[model samples]
Target: MASSDLVRRIVLLVVLCVSGGAMAQTGQDTSLVERGRYLATAADCVACHTTDPAKPFAGGVSIPTPFGQIVAPNITPDPDTGIGKWTDEEFYRAMHEGVGRNGENLYPAFPYDAFTKLSREDVLAIKAYLFSLPAMSQDNPVSELGFPFNQRWILSGWKLLNLRKGEMKPEPAQDDAWNRGAYLVEALAHCGTCHTPRDFSMGSDESRKFGGGAVGSWQAYNITPDPVSGIGDWSDDELVEYMRTGMVAGKGGAAGGMGEAVEHSLSKLPEQDLRDIVTYLRAQKPVRDPADEKPRHGWGAPSEDVSAFRGDETGDDPDGRAIFYGACSSCHGMAGAGTDDGEFPPLFRNTVVGARQANNLVMAILEGVHRTVDGETVSMEAFEHKLTSAEVAAVSNYVLKTYGNPAGATVDAAMVDELRRNAGEQPLVAKLAMPGLIIGVIVILALVFWLLTRRRRRSLR
Candidate 1:
């Protein structure tokens, strides 16, 4: 053969060798991607990432934040619209380091604080899952935060204040179940996102921990071990039942964002994983916030008499009557007779009215009742702000004295002021009390600074 022909043959061989090496790398990448898929599922990536059924992972879900509204972004492998061209290192930086593919900082609205506990390998697994999804062409609108918050540079400063980088550490003292739960809660489940309180600066209050925080229109309750205000009152069986079925006897059912979380993410958790979460939470430190422990109404105790005003004294409170007619008349009925709304438990029925305490009744008025909706029993909205305190007192007293029993004490204007003050000061310990036990693990796991970040310099200051 000629020299030119021989040289061409050699070049072809070199090309084949390069092609073979590329294929091998691709195979390893595919395996990692598969692992990431599982991790993302456990993390409930779909809950916030995908808003439209036609475009999965094309994030545009509007999440309410304390400062403003945040819109999640499309994470598919779309070249123009998603993270399609991002390198593995870029993905790692985003997850473990809280940086974007372009080297800019990410907003903590993504819950990277909890995700920081995720191993690099685990984060890559999630990236793999994200890349495997069908790319969405639709572009999402930017967030609707106010002026200063809308600036991306501000997020970097926020990260400096709050962001941490690390992986979850196995607690040696705890069993495998607790360890697994800690991992899930701290890394994937991120239960503290809602249960934990935030400082005025909007960072998680490490001091108060899962003490509670107000987010947009909703208030996150405390999940500590306080008996009167926290889960100390909840039995293990009751906790399990709530996680499994989303119902608690007196507290209330899940509604709003909570209901969505239960349906999209929690319902998919494995039974063993759920149990682990419960175990880890049950083992947490208890909080002692007396403000959270007090009952909704000070019913049974021999406190000041609120029975001075029974019904319409002047008969001029039109708004009060209208509120009662529009909202409370269904199961409560025109005559306040208990209907078939489950044991529609008469409003004036039993100790709720007769007890010296009026807190139980006040909470009921502020936080409206919930029953079956769309054939499913769902939690309803609390209308504390919707109606005036006198309206609440008037309607409450009307139900108590007229419908169920005469032994019930009447509610008054002064009593309304006291109830509002108490309700407004609700602690995080109280909110976390009603949910599953995993809440505690999430709160505490965030506190383990040394164990989480393997490298000292890698830690969040």
Candidate 2:
């Protein structure tokens, strides 16, 4: 061959080699799809995507972010409404590069940063499971973001600063179980999406990995191995039970977002996987000591603060008596003998009063309870509305102090404000009457107008 021809042939050979390797890396098969299914579950994809059972993978689950509400997109195999038409390469690009099928950058709400740790093979597995799901032709409206956040181009700049592109690499020093747990927790599970704190710019602060996070309406507590502020004191079994059933022995049961996670994802996981998670958590680095951290003045105490709130106020105990008579006595009974069949269970006998930590009572009181009644969730109606923060605090303090357990924490007014803020109650409640009431009235007026018009037409005939 001539020199030019030989050079061209060599270049062609190199191109083929690179292209072949790329194809091998992105290849999709049955096994890969199955792996993806497992990964998606581990990542809690269903918790957000398949929120409404009737609308599985159809997407309309609104996730509250500081910027605005973000809705997870349909990833099912629907050509028009889902990712049915997306090429394998396109899928890879989205998972690895954080770019959409058409090259638009996806918002970090999808947690591609942590997902970026997943191998191409792992991401492909997730894609397979999503595609295998029954596709629905639902078109969820895009979020109504305010100001600069609505711009898609801004995410490109976000990528430049925060996105670190790579795959998971195991720590060789760790055992196989620990390594597996680490990969699942840090990458597939994307636990950091909720647990890790974010900076002002809206990216997770790696320095505080597994530290507490305050998203729009929910607070994801720190799960670091910290003895106080984190899960340092929890045993392996406690961790497993918490993950599997959303209940820990002394720490209280899961509620809110955590409850949902347990119901959808964790509950279905194999026992071994739960054990691995516990092992991994136990081995994690402690973020902070609870004692060293500043004490939160208001919220229900974790146990130690009970005495300060109690004092030598036997006379005030009757005030506690009156409050209980007014509110709790109906269900719990005046003598604190819990109701039969564990329904309206006694205050003295209940786990909340007996818990080593006070989070259960604090959360239950602040958020309130709802037992399933006649196929519908019957809410007991939270006193959060009727009772003052101080009143609620005082009542809770009184219950723990007098009835069955030691005194409750020093949950003052300021603590109430903080909890209310964290729950996103104040903002939503303030606007509830404004829009709903007005809309209801308008709907009634429109119906009346239609009825009047129909009557006039009949009379004319």
Task: List, in order, the clash count of every candidate structure.
Answer: 23, 6
Q: What would the TM-score be for candidate 1 when compared with the true structure?
A: 0.65
- The sequence of per-residue lDDT tens digits that candidate 1 reaches over residues 1-461 is 99999999999999999999999999988888877776776787887888987888899987765345678988999999888999988887777767887777777878888988988778878887887788888688887765445667867767788887778888788899989988987788887877777765567877866655544334445556555545666777766655555554443344434555566666566778778877877777765555432421222221112232243466576344445556666555554444455334334323344333445556667765453423565444577888788788776765554443333346777777765544233334334433534666676786676566656666544
Where is model 1 poorest over a 10-residue stretch in terms of lDDT?
296-305
* lDDT (tens digit, per residue) of candidate 2 on 324-415: 55777677666655445444545553445643334446556677765332233423446777777767667776777654345345556666
Off by over 4 Å in 2: 1-32, 289-461
Look at candidate 2 and tell me the lDDT of residue 410: 57
Off by over 4 Å in 1: 1-38, 295-318, 329-461
Q: How does each model score on TM-score?
A: 0.65, 0.67
Query: Pairs clashing in candidate 2?
Result: 36-125, 36-126, 298-411, 301-409, 338-346, 401-407
Relative to the unseen true structure, what is the C-alpha lDDT of residue 141 in candidate 2, on a scale of 0 to 100?
73
